[model samples]
Target: IVTVAGNVERPRNFEVRFGTPMRDVIVLAGAKPDTDRIIMGGPMMGYAMPGDEVPVVKATNCILVGSPTLFPPPPPEMPCIRCGECAKACPVDLQPFEMYWFSRAKIFGKAQEYHLFDCIECGCCAFVCPSRIPLVDYYRFAKSEIWAREQEKEAADTARERYEFRLAREEREKAEKAAKLAAKAAETKAKLAQQEAAKAAEGTAAPTPTAGDDAKKALIAAAMERAKQQAAAPLNTENLTPDQQAQIADAEARRAQALPAEGKE
Candidate 1:
């Protein structure tokens, strides 16, 4: 658990009393009410509690009381000479100079490329900096900006995906319409074919033999012949000899030659 208070004779850790007032803890630790002190968590991350009456909740760690001596006066701000000392002292080993430039210019994207998210906010860079520039604060601002941009990017991607999905749905609807039209055309053609077949069955004056009907009959006859051959495998075609082969060839030639005469008839 985190605890905080001003000037204590003995600093307590893991103090289990819940909803305790900071004033009570200060009194318990023997405070000189006469002395002016600014107590914070640490020199780095902590800020002064507004008053001693403020109750310490779960987050209070250490109340660092700063008199004139406890927290030293801040070093005067000076111009950064681009010296590499702050870069060396940085725990995250960030390029402080480049980040400093981006922060100064408010160029958040470039700062992110330099891995602004990796900064631990140690304030070591500020401490080591000759210019006393708050490098940690810059990293903090950069991180916030990067987070905001990422959220925006995610929103844009979600919007794009929704648009693409809408387009796909529209295309599918168009394709379904086209397929229905094609099916209707095919059904109409089938109805016409059925009517023609019915007319032929009624012995209309039109010729009964069409090329398609002849092809169908020929295929059926061929299938039947193959089936008969398969059923009687021991049949001896070799015994017929060349004369039988010649005769069969002559019959096929005769049929081909008779086609025009048959069509005329």
Candidate 2:
């Protein structure tokens, strides 16, 4: 509902259709020929439109027609004299001047310390300001900047967590691969020891390649092949850092030492 008042002949409420030109709505209410500007909403909280030719949106609740006598330009802003009238006028009991000083300076953290969010943007502080400072606009700006900073912080935090997780997963995979290779080497060494002991007890200086001996050799060969493959890269090591290269080299060195001993035996 559009509350059509000021400079119109029949000032009353009208169910103005959405998307209709505000000028049409004013004409419907019988606007005076000398109407200077159109303001949406009440005098204190409302803003003046440059022209009434703009189409009205759902937010256009009150259409107050303005003339030179009705709505004169606000006086030049005077310096804050700290009269403290705005504090008394504030329904929320806020220090409007303090918040205004911090917000105007873009020191948003200081504005927050003054409980800036508690402001309902009702424009009461601006209405009573002896300095004629647009206090609510400053508070709104501070709130918007605070919101933007919070979003940036949240995004940065998320990116850091993802990077840390990737690094941890890579290190974990490398450790797992190294452990498997170590276990396999230990098992192969134990089997070789058992074979040597059995042959020494049988009094064979050199064991002939019997079918059973060939089967045992094949088993050892298969285990060694598996250990070699495990020591190979488990995943792509592309673009690895120097630290990663050092870790991979150490694992390969451990495997190399184990395999050489087994091969000599």
Candidate 3:
């Protein structure tokens, strides 16, 4: 059921099918000559249609018309005076004046903290604004800006997480490589120690000296004993007479001649 009202010759309800064009509805109702604009719904909450060619949807309950006397152009927007009328008219009990100030100043975060999205955009606050400030428009603008910023922040957060993860992965790889190198070095050191230990064991297992080496060591000991005995024998010749010294010298010369013959033999 489509209800056509305002600036029409016949302001009455009509039963129509779905997807009906707005032009057909207006023609059925007989649009007035002074109808300047066609609104999709009520005058207070409805949106003015840009053209009549748009088809009516299921939600199109009312098709209102606009005229100079019925729906005049909105007054020029003015700055808020904190009159508190918008706050009073707010059905949601929000502070529209504060929202207006924040939105106009582009302080969208503050606007969100004040429950800006909770506003139904009912136009009640704008209706009561003494300064004719478009409070709802400001609220809408703020909401859009906040949403866009949230999207950008989400993207940034995702990128940061990816970068941090990559850094962690690189650190883990480096640590793993270090561990592998350390293990290899330790293994190599253990092998070298084992080789040194094997060599030491082999040295301790070597054979003892043979009989020939023992004979050589005995000869050296005998020669050392003879030298000791000779050193211990005192020089009694120091106190000997001349005849005794001459006899000793003649005996030494004879011993020297015999030593040379033994060496030749």
Candidate 4:
């Protein structure tokens, strides 16, 4: 639903598709030729749109057409005379002047301390300000800046966590590999020692192949097979589209071609 009113020849509501352009809506309402501004909401809270080319999304409910005569440019901002008009006009009983001062000075923490978020942005403060200080605008700027900084902080924290996790996983894999190598070396050394003892016991006997050597060879072969199996583990395919599954298959095929056969390097 889009409501095109104020400065249009015909002011009314219209049900249109979500992606309908703002210009089309304005045309339906007979927009004035000299429309100076096309705000996206009510007079008080609406933002003046850049142009009518923007599309109407789910949130677009109002389009306040403006002209020079209907909506004149605001007077140059004058210095605040420390009047209590804005505070008195505030419906939430908030000290608008204090928040305004802090916001203008870029002291957002101070503004928040003064209950800035409690402001309903009803435009009462700006409307009643004798100084004509666009106080609400300052409050909006402070809120947006704070929110943006918080988002950046969250992104930085997430990246740090991912990096830490990757490092831990790499370290764990390296430890496991080192432990396996140490065990294999210890087993081979023990087998060789046993073979030397047996040959010494039989003073003049020739040293032939032993079952221990064959066992050692089998252990190495098993380790290599386990490594290959771990490397070629199947990937999770749940919730993937047909195209995504096909892409994964193609990638795996390429990887298989790049890797050598199990027995070779």
Candidate 5:
């Protein structure tokens, strides 16, 4: 069984295809194995596995064999002389030099202001730098910090949204209660008005005798006069025993004597 990942037949293994280099089989399947330059795996995270003679293993995914014409050699490294050339080549417009200085000094917060996380590691800054600096490494550290900050911001935003929603709900509930109270007051007022209207309507529908009305009015007046007399009865203590009545009369006489004479005035 000959297994081909990109092309050709499947079931290709060491047991199926004996004494044959895996590169040749891959080449036969329209894959260029003897390319001049090739990244073994992903460019950002993968390492170059040395030697073309290395046999294929199970861990092998895509053997990214490239050409020298396609992929050029990295620029030669030079000493970093505090030059600002890397800062100018930066596309995110971050001051790579300042960031490098701050990061080297362990002042992470100071480096963050320069938006160090925005660097895409395109090698443009490194390419233009007369003093070769690994700007990407510093950017990676900054990027991690920025990612952490983003998570914190997202959590805070969620909390804020929940608080706002709760406040709005409480306000809505309060308004509903006030509205219900107002509606109940209005209903009570309407009921009172309706009762008054009904009473007036009934009075108009059934006219009572004027004689009975006059008798009721007279009885009410008599009852009011009796109440008033009871209230004013203290002015005359004549109903008391003789000794008490005499004392009251003496007191009144003394009050009359103490009063100013009307005729003299």
Candidate 6:
């Protein structure tokens, strides 16, 4: 059911099918000569349609025909004087003046933090404003700008993530190539060492020791025996002078006296 009223020859309800063109409905209602705009709903909240060519949907409840007398043009906007009337009239209990200030100054993020999207765009704030400011229009403009900036930020972040991923992938590829080259070089070196060892074992024979070589081996054995005997030898104290023995005795006596004092403590 569709209800078409306001500034028409026959303002009444009609049973219409879905997807019905708004033009046919207007013709049935007979639009008045003074009709200057067509609204999809009531005058308080309905949006003005650009033309009558739009089709009626399931949500179409009322089609209001507006004229100069019924819906006059809005007055020139004035600066806000911090009046609380708009806040009082707001059904959502939002601070309209604060939102207006932020929106006018283009500080959209601050307006959003103040719950700007919670505004229903009911136009009550504008209607009750003593300065006749279009509060709803400012809110709408701020919302659009915030949305556009958010989209731009998201795109930039995605590009940055892609670039970082590309750099990481290139670094990983370079590391893998370097590792493969290092492994190949090590394997080649090991194979060459093994071949050299095999050639030495197959072709080279141990030469007979000369007199000089025998003498060098005998000297090295004697040095090693001397180092072992020195490591096993104990310190000799039999040759100490009488005066040195007396000094050692005195030191031992002092250590014994300090031990008794520490035990007492």
Best by TM-score: 4
lDDT (Cα, tens digit) per residue for candidate 4, span 1-265: 7888999999999998988889999999999899988999988888889988889988889999999999888898998888899989999999999999999998989999999888888899999887888988998998998888889999999999999999999999999999999999999999999999988889977668799989999999999999999889876776799999999999999889778665386
Using lDDT, give the best candidate's number.
4
Question: lDDT tens string, model 2, 1-265?
Answer: 8889999999999887789899998998999988898998887777788888877888998999999889777788888888999999999999999998998899999999999999988899888887888888788889999999999999999999999999999999999999999999999999999999987888956556799988998999999999999889566688889999999999999999999899999
List clashing residue pairs in candidate 5.
1-11, 2-12, 3-10, 3-11, 3-12, 37-66, 38-66
Global lDDT of each model? 0.76, 0.90, 0.89, 0.91, 0.66, 0.90
Q: By descending lDDT, how would the candidates be arranged?
A: 4, 6, 2, 3, 1, 5
Q: Model 3, residue 256: what's the lDDT?
A: 99
Misplaced by over 4 Å in model 4 are 204-265
Screening candidate 4 with a backbone cut-off below 3 angstroms (N, C-alpha, C), the clashing residue pairs are none
TM-score, one value per model: 0.53, 0.56, 0.55, 0.74, 0.40, 0.62
Q: How far out, in Å, is residue 123 in model 4?
A: 0.9
- lDDT per residue, candidate 1, 1-265, as tens digits? 5353445565565464657776777666666545355455677766666777776666666766555555556777677899998889988888887887797688987887877777777778888888888777777777777788889999999999999999999999999999999999999999999999988888856666889999999999999999998988866665787989999899999999999899999
Q: What lDDT score goes with residue 133 in model 1?
A: 81
Better of 3 and 4 by TM-score: 4
Candidate 6: segments with Cα more than 4 A from true spot = 1-35, 40-42, 53-63, 205-265
Q: What is the TM-score of candidate 3? A: 0.55
Instruction: Please give the range of 10 consecutive residues that has the lowest summed lDDT in model 2.
Output: 200-209
- The TM-score of predicted model 1 comes to 0.53
Q: Show the colliding residue pairs in model 1.
A: 2-60, 2-61, 3-60, 3-61, 3-62, 4-61, 4-62, 4-63, 5-63
Q: Could you give the C-alpha RMSD of every candidate to the true structure, in order shown?
A: 24.4, 31.8, 12.2, 37.2, 19.7, 28.3
